[model samples]
Target: MTIKKLVEQIEAKKSFLCVGLDVDLEKIPTHLLEEEDPMFAFNKAIIDSTHHLAVAYKPNTAFYEAYGLQGWRSLERTIEYLNERHPDIFTIADAKRGDIGNTSTRYAKAFFEDLQFDSVTVAPYMGKDSVEPFLAFENKITILLALTSNAGAFDFQTRSLEDQELYKQVLQTSLNWENAHNLMYVVGATKAEYLADIRAIVPDHFLLVPGVGAQGGDLEAVCRYGLNKQVGLLINSSRGIIYASQGRDFAEAAAASALSLRTQMQQILDAR
Candidate 1:
């Protein structure tokens, strides 16, 4: 889908929420373990319950990779289900994959073609050659990792190089890449203070921001600095929403959690 369509969805739903499908079998309700594909079953339940409340669903590839063949199958089925039933909802493969030229091409194909995700997260340390391949796909976004939510981000992302923070350089340099309009970014909400500077670099591009709920990132602070006229942010809440309950009412609890965030988002939109 185009970024225009994504913006339309956010406006129509009064939300820019992206529900993370980082499903952990151990954390899911025990009852689902009996299903032929417990991971997909749990994901389906959450997606069905909260589809109206979210504009995107991100399934970190590691979750599926850990389970081997069955896990991969679950991931495939999950994407197919979303495409068939909720095609409007943006899909992200949070694989964080990057490699040399040829390798990155295959990685892009795996997600954008094989899995058919609307976007995927990629590490940009390998420079332009590593990311340009993903941008080749029309209408597909390549969300490069910038300042992340994890504590370890400060080690390199914030370090000054040539009198500029490395992350800032990444954003500035990306503008020169081919088809840069198809590019988005992963800016961790935990570092909300950095959003202002980040936005100054690329104010119109979409930001796939995680660390909002479970990691205690302030939603208001993120929006104060990050939101564009198009609502250029997808605030994700994984464990905080999907695992709101472990009992029979798990789906209901998940919906409640999503609703709370969506309501807050609506207020922000109205204020805008």
Candidate 2:
């Protein structure tokens, strides 16, 4: 979807909430295990229950890749269901993929053509060449990793090179790449304080923020520094929402959890 379309969805729903569909069999309701494809079954229920409360759904690829063929099938079915049903809801394959020339193009095809994701998370460490291939695809976005939510982010992302920090350089350099306008960023909610400085460099681009509920990243603080005129924030809550309950009312509970975040988002948009 275009950024304009995404903005419209947020306005229509009174939400910029992006639900993370990082499904885990061990954590899902045990009853879902009885289904033919437990992972897709769980995802279908969650999407059906909570699609209105969220404008985006991100599925980290590793979770599905780990399950091998069965896992791959589940991932395929889940995306198909979303595309066939909730086409308006932005889909992100959090693959964090980057590779040499031809390889990168194939990766792009795998997600954009085969999986039909609107966007894919990509590692910026390889610089322009590795990322531009994904950007080459029309209307598809590459969510380049910047400052992440994990504790290890500080090790390299924050380190000063010459005078500027590594992550800052990554942001500034990426803008010069071909099709740079198609770029969004993965700025973790835990790194909320640095958002103002990050915004100084790339203010208009949407930020796919993780680390909110379960990770204790302050939603208010993230918005204070990160909100652009378009409300360029997709504040995500994965485990905190999807795993809100492990019982029969799992879907209902997930919707309730998502509703809480969406309500807060609506208030923020109202005050804006």
The per-prediction tally of clashing pairs is: 0, 0
Q: How many pairs of residues collide in model 2?
A: 0
RMSD of each: 1.1, 1.0
Model 1 TM-score is 0.98
lDDT, candidate 1, 41-113, per-residue tens: 9999999999999999999989899999999999999999999999999999999999998999999999999
Q: Please give the range of 10 consecutive residues that has the lowest summed lDDT in model 1.
A: 211-220
TM-score of each: 0.98, 0.98
Runs of candidate 2 exceeding 4 Å displacement? 214-217
lDDT of 2 by residue, 149-233 (tens): 9999989999999989999999999999999989999999987889999999999999999889943349889999999999999
